[model samples]
Target: MIHSLVFLNGFEREITVGNALVTSYFKCGCSSFGRQVFDEMLERNVVTWTAIISGLSQNELFEDSLRLFLKMRHGMVEPNFLTYLSSLMACSGLQALGEGRQIHGLVWKLGIQSDLCIESALMDMYSKCGSLEDAWRIFESAVELDEVSMTVILVGFAQNGFEEEAIQFFVKMVKAGTEVDPNMVSAVLGVFGVDTSLGLGKQIHSLVIKRSFGSNRFVGNGLINMYSKCGELQDSIKVFSKMPQRNSVSWNSMIAAFARHGDGFRALQLYEEMRQEGVEPTDVTFLSLLHACSHGGLVDKGMEFLKSMTEVFRISPRTEHYACVVDMLGRAGLLNEAKTFIEGLPMKPDVLICQALLGACSIHGNTEVGKYAAEQLFLLEPDNPVPHVLLANIYSSEGRWKERAWTIKRMKEIGVVKETGMSWIEIDKKVHSFVVEDKMHPQAVIIYGVLAGLFRLMKDEGYKPDKRFILYYLDQDVKHN
Candidate 1:
């Protein structure tokens, strides 16, 4: 095809045709061919540069796209909206916050910051790069915010764990008279995953129905996930049953919901139904099944799916799948088998896999194997404090005071301190965080009083605090006090 194009119009003269050929080749996934044509071009314009950069970004060749953008700047081609858009996308993919900020500066320098599409893309880039503050700044500076712009900001907020802020912004956008689209609704639904208020979820569901977006597959799937994560299995089932069309995501979500709730029989039944409906199971589908088997003690079923993943579906099990198997075995008290599985893995077991085994050993008071897993975790993630903490807990549970004391000493010697446990609640669009025994809240006295009252009532009702969680270094008198 290149030969034919070159034969018809000598490459140097037909810059337009050459640019078209580069774009066509890139669109066809022939990036090498596109580069060859781009290299052969004697007269490269902004369009040609933008075409290749956009193709590379869209195809997820982010580094190459950024490199070409650098070259384009050196080539003295001033970037327009398309160029900035593609480059910003590449920045997002690579999580290049510095480069994205530089591009934002370039946008201001070029006097194109007013371009809504470019502004939206900039917010998206900053959001994906973990600069939510910068993204919010871009959004606040926008003269006229569109639905796409609002949606990107909302998604950014959600992805960055600013759920309350995201929900507040959604409410603010609606109050400002911007028409909400399916994408925006989907983004809003994500907030519910973190904020597990059944009342709030149902209010959103009502809004979805009123807006006639109830039938949207994406929205439906989001509702299912939100409900499941919130521990409302019935609501998730309700959403799944009401969806007009069920995709693999919907099926997998419902299956996972049941599995997570410890109804492995129902989860397996749903998987069978999904297969009968000719909706193929994805990697996520198998993950949910394995999770159910692990939690529900259906180890045999989990093993069968692990084998069938490769043999029947021709889908290679990823590290996550293998980790699930290890978790299942460990949880079922098959500690030796789990260790053997890890040793025999085709790839190195990640720290999370070892952590799972270590956790299971802690629960079952298997000190010997737990110690080995903890040591492996120390090697895998030297700076991580979890293994050290968990190992100490395991020793404490088994009444091995000396070992627990040694573990604590080793943690201090290695300069590995456990992070303080913290919790947060979002109230009226504001998030308030508190650490253990926090006294920072304005109403801390009242809150503490209420908590003390609840603790007294719980003790009266036969609730007992587990003392094994306390550090063994502390004296028994101190612990009692």
Candidate 2:
């Protein structure tokens, strides 16, 4: 009604009314109308642009947001700090590292300083773009460190496989008297895996209750994620049910928890419940739904959801979504169909598709498909040791020792190296790290001797270990071609 009134009165031509209308429309989730109001405006300023750009980003229309930012610059309008911050967020959401770097350069050149929101957005962009080195540099160079910035960088480290680094930094925040924040708790919890997060998550849950943060939607979502990561599906459900409010993230989190716990039917039920409550499912929700179907061996159902995502929700499938469909087929032992699907992609296959196909091929002993997948990986990421290692394993299983030798040899000739794999275990209230192999442990010989005995016994009893789990030590040598 108010929108109609504005249209009837021609009030959208006023700058303040137009800006507020745009921002309010986006906040109310009527983005199409927000866009219409924005386009009808006769005058636009920095605030107007910021409102529209930020609204576009908030509505998950990231590419449009950045396009408008570029257009704004081309029109000789200077973007203020809020504009840059919103643009950085769009870059982060899109994972457009190149554009994000350009924005960073422009910000530095324009002397935008001491704005924590922009600093955090910068860190988020670099981190989400998979450049933790740049994120750390930005964090260190900051003139100030606050709770929000620290939380962003901590999340960067945790999500980018720097779990140990993230944990150490979380300790620093505690020592510096940083108050507990939803983001901080979530990031710290994310630094651990499987059983590692449970104890800390519980402690944090207690702290959240003590501080009256239990009702916070963000924290509630974090708890759901934390419980799911720890494999405590029941606990996650309990938390989800207790929340007085739920957003799309809340629903998606619970659904993902069900998917992670191998309860595809319950995940579907929750998805149904979400839709019945008039809550719209986002791409992440579908990712979980597809994952549930994939792992549950519901290939036909997975295909249906894949179609529904784009058709019903009007979401364009991302690389990850394509990867899931391939994963669905691959996990169901439909190697030929998986390959065909990849061939039919509108875009070139990415690392996720290659990795999924390679793993599936390994499981099913589809040597030809495995070789093709590994070759694609070699071309796409030459320095990556995973394809070389996994392909060599495929060769080893087929008694094609020459091909295996060539694969590993090519890896060495190109100076490719693999990070040392690590595993941990807890027993009798103590944790042990055993990835040191023969290097650091005082009783390495004894441990290996015992392990060898166990393997011998298991083999004698007709038990065989999965060959995919074994990582052979790389011996360096040159290769032909």
Candidate 3:
């Protein structure tokens, strides 16, 4: 159309005609063409400048968008709310914290901080840059915190591991009488993982039901995730059954919950059910299923499912899928096959994949593979101590004390200290974590006394000390002491 206009009509087009063509191109997402028209214009107004900047920003050319903003300033075009909003969005996309701060100052100087769109964009910018503190400050200082600002701040806190802060603001939002939408709940729930507080999660779940957000797929998925992480498999299943709609995430969550609980059979059953229900399994779903198979030692079942991932589902196996296959093979004591599989992988095996093989080697006492895996893992993550520890354990089990000592010496030289294993149990909403020989607890003395009495009773019943329980440092004198 522009070519026809130039060839038949003339090269000399009216400013209004050029602007209309540019606007049409910008609307059609042809920012480059709009920019060409913009360059050809003899007189560029504020609207013309804003249109191009907005177009560039929308197209994700953030730096170019920002550069255009600078050009608008050089041309003495006074920016309006739309100009600032577009620039702020560019800053948010690029996570340009310094530029965003400059924009904040400009907004303040222009006395447009109270403008909802500008303020919301500022909040989103800070949040996207991981500056939750700044996001919260803007949110609190806003004359009116709309749902967009509130949800952005809430999600920012949650994603940054400030779960407590997120929940607090959530309550305050409720008290201030802001309507909580499913999107807000979904954003908050996305950050709730295996380590989140179950009680707090339950409160969120109850709120979802009370607010009638339970019917929302996002809310339902959040509930499924929260229940799964809380170790409430039954509740997770209940939520799954009641969900009016189920996405791949819902199925994956249930499969993951069962896998985590070591109920591989049930996980497999659900996988099959998911197929029967016509909900296709995703990569994550297969990963969870593979984990279940590995843990339950279902070698044949695991292999079949792994094959189905590529053949039946037509999903290309990624590094994570390969890692699971290696883990499953290693865990089942198919050491040679595991090594061959890793070597045969199109992509290089990552440290986690190698570490999985090392763990299996430790359990099966395969010193050869364990040593090789340890070497590879050490090269990948020199600071990690697990590979060294596993290697030491393998040598010790094989009665190769000299090799074990050498491994420990190398670890010491590298300043790698084995982290003591700790287990935690949540009781009555409080978590209690303990390490072996931990004497810092108030009830440590009483717990030791009970253990001593139990040991005595076991000794009287012809029980003997399992040398496996003793640390390498524990000698006769230490045991007596």
Residue 422, candidate 1: Cα error in Å is 6.7
- The model with the greater lDDT, 1 or 2, is 1
Query: Tens digit of lDDT per residue, candidate 3, span 1-481?
Result: 6646764776545666666777778778887888898898888777877778888888888998898897777777799889999999999889999999998899899999889888889888998898988888888787886778777888788767788677677767767878989888887776765555677778878888888998898788888877887778888889989999888988898899899889999999998899899998888998999999988999888889888889988988877878888889998899989999888888888888899899888888899998889989998999999998889888877878888889889999989988998766666765667787888988888977887778677768876553322263222443433
Over 4 Å off in model 2, which ranges? 1-112, 115-146, 159-161, 195-197, 273-278, 427-431, 436-438, 442-446, 464-481
Number of colliding residue pairs in each model: 0, 0, 0
Q: Which candidate wins on lDDT?
A: 1
Name the runs in model 1 displaced over 4 angstroms. Answer: 1-44, 412-481
Give lDDT for model 3. 0.83
Of 1 and 2, the candidate ahead on TM-score is 1
Model 2 residue-pair collision total: 0
Every candidate's CA RMSD: 4.4, 5.6, 5.2
Ten-residue region with minimum lDDT total, candidate 1: 471-480
- Give the C-alpha lDDT of model 2: 0.85
CA displacement after TM-score superposition, residue 29 of candidate 3 (Å)? 11
As a TM-score, model 2 comes out at 0.76
